[model samples]
Target: MGEIWMIGATGRAGRNISAELQADRHRIVLVGRNGQRLAEAAAAIAALGGPPPRTLVTDDPLAQIATGRPDVVVNTVGPFGATTVPTAHACVAAGSHYVDLANEFQPVQSLLGLDPAARTAGSTLVTGAGFGTLATEALVSELCAGRPSPIRVRVAAMPVVDGLGPAVLASVVDAAATGGLVYRDGRLTRSRLGAHLQHTPLPDGTMRATVAVPTGELEAALNASGAGDVIATSSEVPTGRIARVALPIVGAVLRVEAVRRTVIRLIDRWQLTPPATPGEVSWAYASTEWEGGETRQAWLQAGEGYAFTSRVAAMVATRLADGDARPGAFTPGALFGADLARSAGATITLDSNAKDLR
Candidate 1:
């Protein structure tokens, strides 16, 4: 088995992905900032009745990637706007394949923009290997596969997570700071945060209020569908009338660097988070409209968000370690198709009006 280095090995996503890889008898090296925590995680992995994982404690992840030069690096670190670029650059420089569960718009775009360099180095870089972008992106691809280029594409991600971590919160805050972003005329454009509020009907006959948010799904959907207009919304965003009214004000404050930092600091110190009772099912929907009157829609149903994320990340990492991936940057959906999510316990349902592209 190829050697794989897992950054943030002790974190939630890292722990789950490591367990998945280890269960398959893959050789893994747990890398984290805390030596004790990394050791503890390794112990837990060993206790799971597989090969014990090696440990590396380091604050400088780039340095570790450069020197240690593992065959593959799975970066589970977050607020990826700050970590993704440098880490990816290091992986390219070191000629190591890289994969990350990053769903932020900036980092996803940044990593995908590294195609030339990654190709030159013969290293594959996959981003948005998590529930954030993959689910919606997969749906977009499924809906647009047999059809011509769509004029408009709308995608929504509504994951039911069992819990939230500080990193996830930070990522949300960072996206909020970015305000509303949508692809228009094949270009990224700005709008108010929580703008384009609408009621999204889930597969279970339940309607959830969703709002426009800056997410990697926006970019992924555009690339996958080649749509001229695309909007990415999420059920995780606040959608009440009050929230809609206050979003502009909040978005303005977050745009200020100092204010954004203070808010993030407060969130961390206060441990402010939403409740933890996640539902058993997560839903992602995509609707595509061509120039005439034709339209298509699809629903991607998956298991628990975190569990599906772990499986998706594991599957992608396994493919990378086994040299099944091509040298370039990609979203899981763009690289592996919607079936990747199904293999990770997801189901795709198409509207009666839409053709079953699968």
Candidate 2:
């Protein structure tokens, strides 16, 4: 249905996005710094279904792509803490929609300024398309579906058990080292990771997820949602048959980057993780307390968070190609509404756990 230029298509998360989109018969154009990696991604995705998209490797991507053209450019480039401006500029110049898997908060401060330029250029720009806050944002939204006086949002996510690449490992450490973005008294503030804590429950049982500063994704999502008394947080959750016993230790480890760093080095050095698999699961729930009546709640458990992000990204690309989505820089939540976000392939849960809270 669409041609999406997939940058960093070989990364594990990027591959997952491509895998799901491939099932839908969407054509993925693999773009990366390396021709070899891009070719490998192209072949793999092509095998899934649909014709392989035009693969291009260029230092000057905009100059190179001015001719063949694409519907949208899905950037898989890491840390976008560094290279978003040029890519955003190129996408507008190429007349293509732009999306990235960036999670850094500093970059968004600058990118948000692109709203006017993007509107004038007629291009849609979205970043933080990764796993950071999309699911959490949706959870918070479905939690407060009805008009509620005040809503409380909390989230915890960690990849402690998964097979993480060096880059992924590096990103996690960097994000942690910088402490977290904290929202206080309606102002964006800062907090050290593991500074605050709460024991949150999972399908299995209860675990501790510390409160930290929300990333750009969470910040944008909450601001756009415009909920009353809303606070969102993301932290690591430890799981295992005997893992519950280790929550305190895990929580302690996450608090200090030096401690976490040693552990990550050991993980990398030892090959402790499983196969770098494409499937990743993200589960989130939210609660809403209104002025009267009863409180409402909703929870979501998903098996395909990575791919769904890609599928939604493809939808973004295709629409940008057709000139449907609004032009300008935005977070996924800034786009707003479950109906519109569905285009990004996020499923909703009707069995809200609003009642029965003691």
- Deviating ranges (above 4 Å) for candidate 2: 62-69, 145-162, 202-208, 227-230, 237-281, 288-296, 339-358
The C-alpha lDDT values of all candidates are 0.87, 0.58
Model 2 — TM-score against the truth? 0.74
Return the lDDT, model 2, position 345: 49
- Per residue, candidate 1 scores C-alpha lDDT tens digits across 1-358 of 6898999899898999999998899999999889999989999999988778999988898998999888899988777887888888999999999989888788898899999999989999999998978999988888888879999998889899888677778777787788888888988898888898867777666777788988899989999999999998888877889989998888788879998888778877897765564678899988888898687888988888888999999999999999888888888998899999889988998884843121
Candidate 1 lDDT (Cα, 0 to 1) = 0.87
Q: Write the per-residue lDDT of candidate 2 for residues 1-358, one digit (tens) a residue.
A: 4467776677776676677666766666666677888788878878877777557786666665566567777776654654576777777877777887666566565567777888898878887664555666666566655554343444443322245545555445445445545555456665544444544455445543634443564465455445444444444422333444444444455558577667666755764533343435555545455554456555555554555555556555555545568878887656645454555544556444535232
Runs with alpha carbons beyond 4 Å of true place in candidate 1: 266-274, 352-358
